[model samples]
Target chain A: MTRLVVLSAGLGVPSSTTLLADRLAAAVVRRLGGEAEGRVEVERVELRRLAHPLADRLTTGFAGEELAAALEAVHGADALVAVTPVYAASYSGLFKTFVDVLDRDALEGTPVVVAATGGTPRHSMVLDHALRPLFAHLRAVVAPTGVFAATDDFGDAGLDDRVERAAGELVALLSGTATTRTRPTEDERLADPTPFEELLRRAGAGPTG
Target chain B: MQLGIFSVGDVTTDPTTGRTPTEHERIRAQVAIALKAEEIGLDVVALGQHHNPPFVASAPTTTLAWIGAQTRRILLSTATTLITTTDPVRIAEDYATLQHLTGGRVDLMMGRGNTGPVYPWFGKDIREGINLAVENYALLHRLWREDVVDWQGRFRTPLQGFTATPRPLDGVAPFVWHGSIRSPEIAEQAAYYGDGFFHNHIFWPPEHAAQMVRLYRERFEHYGHGRADQAYVGLGGQFFMRKDSQAAVREFRPYFDNAPVYGHGPSLEDFTSQTPLTVGSPQQVLERTLGFREHVGDYQRQLFLVDHAGLPLKTVLEQLDLLGEILPDLRAGFAEGRPAHVPDAPTHAALVAARADQEVPA
Candidate 1:
């Protein structure tokens, strides 16, 4: 079964980010069709209300029931979607702290899609420099597709088509139809030295030399 | 030696007498602590964000941005920027604005919070935290890099020729360090991007912390970021300092014992010995911290927890003063002793230079 997990970090009720997450999940449900949905169980973990000590390590405590349950959901999930409010131009600390408590390899090999909501459209790079690096460090197979929703993007006047399109692409990526291109293999490395030159050398060089 | 100080943004009572301080006092004291960190020559001050009763700081970036305006040099950061529930678009925009406001002296650590009820409060499910982070960040990256992003993802709607305004300073994204304690997945996430990995080592023992960092360093190299040593790394710790080691332990015991987070658990001594909690003199604190490099290798940042346990702002300020005086020399000494092979902070200039070097001739 293709288990899906949705983690949300927004604070506002009727949050635009949360609405977007629902739409994303719905798109995934739609894309997978009845067959996939029947077998694919979808779960959600919201990290905003877990016990304080579990999230913040200043106090030595185990993961709270909420966080533990969320962790369990993550353990079984095949693909994940995470959303957060943009604060200080990155993921929220509450969100990051929950991530801090998880086992390092829990998300390995799992495909993931990311999204964020903020008042303005300025902090877009946070996905690359902050959030993406966080997940990539966890070893999850993240989709190249991501969605960023600005406060202005919400409401009937906007965001309808963009949400559907982003969600659809995410379904594609999660289903492996939009697999990220492989970095050239050793044989391919030497043959396709043109593109690999900087990346390989900058990556501290592979054994292919 | 990436010197870091984190503020839980709380006030505490005298641990010696088992007294509790007012929350208002704790909030004021956190500001003084950050200023003292700068004076002490710490590299970063990462403020945590929490909306619960005990924690006064709900908006970390607001504080960080304010700190950015006040502090001249110390890099301002958030201990964890929640990506799962918050909008990635807002994150992109706010941080970009922060970047401009701070003259590019800002960066952040991304995280998924622990609170489950927050999901429902925000009208999201508790199930898809990871997926949300993945999809949101993908769009955020495009918003920053591409002048016109035609992006579509599951967690957020697609963008057709959308361009996030107030673009990053010189089109260079802020440097990031992925922080985790137990989660290898977070470390792996950091490594895959060839970015920094931070292990909050205050609670875990040396071996566990070392193992996490080692995994990240190895995977960073695997993901083609850099040599293991060159991978940016950070660590978290808790410390209390006094001239007398006994005085340090004596003074910190009550706070440690009553701390809502760790209270009613392990004896203070046991916890201190088992984890990174160092209740000792300034010299001892320095020695213990210096030892971190032995296990973790040459790391990029080190953050300490000093503002929790309801420690009054005044006391926290004192701790900051002491840390400031001792830390500059510590950082300098570490730099002098560090091996030349280790990588340094991923500063904005480095990002610009790296990208410049990456450009294929137009």
Candidate 2:
């Protein structure tokens, strides 16, 4: 089963950022086996709810239950739809905070559809300026098309085209038809471990016989 | 199980009273706490090694030597000795000397120091942390066993036919525990050498610690140390207790809220529930402690962290008193299901006797 994680950094109950995320996720599911087919499972993470845990993690170096679960969901995701309301000309602080909580290589090679909702179309640059660079550093394969919905653009028909394009791009990458990335088989240095003798040899110390 | 107390030697402010202890007072307080541990019949007093301020245990050997002079039985150990930065030659000499001074009442834990600046300050590189731990410990292990060592490693200057002075007491090196907050290689290192692995069972969730222990145990058996369960394992935990659980919660709350490390983060209630932090009566502390066996299996050593985060010297002593009240019950609880073959935590006497039985240095 392909797990789709939608991370929305909207603070309001009826938030446009989450609405954009929902549209993108639904469009991707439609492109795949569809929601009724059950091949694609969607898990929505409201970054607003993770506020307290993120701050606590920053201070304590621990993830409480909710934050750990959200991180686990993201880690398991075959694809991601991240939607954040632009704040201070960038993705919401809550969105970045959640990103900060992730392990350095958590999203490596994962396909992502980046979207944002903003009060002004001028802040639309945030998708390229903020979210794109951030996910690039995390080594995610972001969809070629990124959706940016301004409050005014939300009513326009052009918005649907961008959301569908972004979803189609993500689905293509998720299905491995348009492959630009590989997860670089996990370095099993810790998982399976390098034998102690090899480590000693690498460190210029031979193993004791 | 060998029950003990380990201090990070944190000089923190008393949150409620707005009083920060002078480094001198905090340093002296550490001695008092260690002495109290012995006086109250606890088995060990382990001190942390930190090269930075806010932590004053840089010269732990000197402090442990002093504590050893005043005490008769309590073991002197390091919550961790900085194996990454400090020269292995120095560790070999100093700890062996400590073994002599303490009348063989010593065992030390090897740890890569957490502070990043410490590596550069000590003329080492931070990026070589695992390499340093691996190579340095390999050298220290030989320095203790081999009469004269010709050694070369990536992190340190080569030694040709060099002998570390004051070779380990009675020709039996002190047992070493490798400690790491979240490093897998350290667990593997501990297993490779058949050393004890200590998981600081605080700050993070218990499940994470369980995985680390599981990995160490599996590797220990693979390395031919013993059965996985027989591999030496030590756990670290923290608590604040009183006769009544409510009073314990009320008193520790203010300190838990504003003290360093975990302060101002998770609520006292949430922290206690998630981590192995028991903030309640002695019985509650005992109950939570026994639950550790369920996670890590039958174990060897258990170290509790106390006397940090600016809980006053008086309160720390009181916590020790409460710990003492439950020591019998705690030991009995640990002993009940533990098999007879599971070795007790290694000590100098035990090591010396074991060496005598083998008639060969290991």
Candidate 3:
């Protein structure tokens, strides 16, 4: 089964950020129809509900139950659709904080579709400037096509077209049709126990035997 | 089971009084606390090392040696001695001298100091913390056991024909406990050497302590030390108590709300519920402490944080009195139905006897 997680950093009920996230999730599900065969699961995490907990995490260095559940969902998902309301020409503080709280390697190699909603089309650059770079730092495979919705694009067909294109890119990556970015396999140098003999040798002590 | 108190040696203002103890006063108070531990029949008095302001315990061996001179039965130890930055040769020499001064009543806990800048202060890097610990401890382990050692490691200068002065008393090295809050490699290190693994059980939830202890035990058996249940495990706890539970909470709330480490984060009530913090009567403290065995299984040592967050020495002594009242019950509760094969916390006398047994003809 394919699990898709939607992270919506929307501050208010019926927020446009959540609306964008829902549209992206729906588009991905629509594209997954034949291959997924009703085996796709969608989970939504509203950062608005986790504001206080996120603050607690910053202070205490641990996540509360609800936030932990959200992190677990994200960690286990096959792909992610993250949408945030652009604040001060970038992703909202709440969105960045949620990402910051995740384990350093939690999102490694996970496919992600980055989207954003902002006041002006000029802020559309946030998808590339802010969101894409953040996921790239986490080693996530970000889809090449990113969807940005300004206030005026909410009800327009243009928004739907962009969402479909981004969702198709994500679906193609997930379905093994598109070439995803490659990451170096995890280092195994530390995996095995350094033989006691080798450790003694490094310490300039001959092997006891 | 061995019962004791460990202090981070912070100098903070008493929140209720808004008065801070001087560095001199705080240092003296630590010695007094150690004396009090022996007087009250406690087993151990461990102090932490911090090289920054608001913390004055930069030299633990010096302080412990002073405490050792005044106290007879109390075991002196470092809550943790920094292994990553400090030269292992100095650690070997200083602790060995301390063991001699105290008549072998010494053991030391190894930890990678937490402050980021402490690394650079000692001309080391915090990025190589785990490797430094692994290498430094391996060298330290050999220095104490071997009369002469030739050693080279990444963190410090090489040693040739080096015999650490004042060899460990009776030729039995002071017991070592690797103290780690979140590192699995540390647990593995302790297991590899058949040493003790101590989890500071006060800050986080019980599950974290359980997980670390479980790993240490599994790896201990993997190294052919013993059964998993026989692995040496020590846990740390924190508590503040009064005759009445409500009064205890009322009295400790101000200190808990403004103190360092956890002050600004979770509320007192929330922190107590989430961690192994008992702020109530002596009976309640005993019950909560005894419950630790349920998660981590039968363990060897139980240390408490009794004097921190600017509690005045008088109040800390009173807390010790309350602890003295409950120590018997706590000890018995932990000892009940404990298996015979499980080892007690390693002590000077026990180590000496084990060495004697080995030297004897089979």
Candidate 4:
């Protein structure tokens, strides 16, 4: 029942990044093949047209009808791929704001592949210094093969290759076939187990009266 | 500690020199500032979003995405990405894609934005600005974390079973800093979700910034994210540096007088004295910046306004050189001096390490 989730944070109706996400999902589907024992569903969440802001106020809890399903999908997904347009040398505010809404561990141990589309090839570094740290904070296992395509880099064939390669890479990571450097070194990921269970117990306790 | 240089990208005439830089020149200067930030070993370089006369960064994402391609070690961030007016769905998809391209070196600061007229231009109500921000961010949050969203509410159409494309890199969404100048409500919102609180402390005095940060920290702990000290914090600042403090003031005078955002407001000297603006030498700049920790506590990110008021590209590049030479040492020194109780960058390794440590028996 492993599910692949594609989260698109792009502008423009016909986006290069969305296409990339689709191609990624397809590659995962292809890799999973019949080996997928349960329903291997592919889901996409377009952010631009959403109704409410991701950050909550005093009245709102992490619950709203619009967000309930999305939260469920995230909690349920076995793998995730997030794509955004680099803004101000980082992921878009829209993208980050969305992340702000989730529990800190929403992506804990999940595999992710970051992708971006821009006007030039100069901004590829945002993947490592800006976006990676945020996800790293959430404890997501990122895919080493992140994809960046500039306006100039995209034509018919090159664009296809970029999308296919990113999709293929995510599939490899999800299927445990690809070596994902986006993750912490095994020892690092294996941080002390005591603190984690305390965290769980504390979380279970909730806000005590 | 996240250190960055932010650019306003203003094209203006230097009143003393009687020369005006073209918009293209201004944009180039902003780029140079970013490169200088990297050369100086700063952690990040952020660009502000402004679509009006005198400002050149109409497409902040385009510019930052370009910067992402060039830098290696510096994290990229946005001073403000409009959540109220800009479509959250587009923001989600675009940034998710960017995350993949950049190898995960990204995050952003969200704002309701300053320009009021911008609301109606996007066919929105300015009066409902706060509501727009609240609703839009809520949906945007869901989109990044979830895959199949059946969303229905105001602002956008209902979705039966909609899926946003190009999921977030590794299923984790980007980190966010909610930037606010006067709104405690925004601070409260950031706290409620355990997100970072960015008090763009440029215009405000220390007391106000301290109060805002305090509120955010208290609420963050209340929400069970972590302790008050662990709450993420980023502050905004303005700086103009030269070897000589007096010379720096003399050179920056014309730009300060005529600059759009601060032009004809408080005297630049008075503004710097009262606010976070530090107009002085590199050593003075470092000393003044490190002082921010006094009020804000162990902060997460610090961004400086370096390119604005129509400063020439060459002059800005020189400033960057000075910043680059001084800032790396300052960052290391600052980190070394930080209290052990302060939280560091919330990295995956750190999170896993902390989790593992928590799991181990005493």
Could you say which candidate leads in DockQ?
A: 2
Which of 1 and 3 is ahead in TM-score?
A: 3
> Number of clashing pairs, model 2?
0
Name the lDDT value of residue A16 in candidate 4.
Answer: 75
Segments in model 1 whose C-alpha atoms lie over 4 Å from true places: A1-209, B11-25, B359-362
Q: What shift in Å separates residue B294 of candidate 2 from its native position after superposition? A: 0.7
Tell me the docking grade of candidate 2. medium
Give the TM-score of each candidate: 0.63, 0.96, 0.94, 0.61
The residue-by-residue lDDT of candidate 1 on B60-129, one tens digit each, is 7777887787899988888887776777788888888888998888888877777787777766665666
Off by over 4 Å in 2: A177-191, A205-209, B360-362
Scored by lDDT, model 4 comes in at 0.73
The digit string of per-residue lDDT tens for model 3 on B53-122 reads 9899999998998999998899888888999888899999999999888899999999998889989999
Where model 3 places Cα greater than 4 Å from the true spot, the runs are A34-38, A177-209
Candidate closer to the true structure by lDDT (higher is better), 2 or 3: 2
Q: Taking the tens digit of each residue's C-alpha lDDT, what string does model 3 give over A8-68?
A: 9999788999999999999998887733586688899999999987887887666767888
In order, the candidates keep a fraction of the true contacts of: 0.13, 0.58, 0.13, 0.00
lDDT (0-100) at residue A128 of candidate 2?
A: 96
Q: Calculate DockQ per candidate and list them.
A: 0.06, 0.50, 0.26, 0.01
* DockQ (0 to 1) for model 4: 0.01
lDDT by residue (tens digit), candidate 2, B1-362 = 89999999999999889899999999999999999999888998999999998899999999999999999999999989999999889999999999888889999988888788998999987777888888999999999999989987777889999999898899989999999878888899999999999999788889888888988999999999889998999999999999999998999999899868888887998888889999998889999999999999999889999987889999999899888889999989999978888899888888888878898755
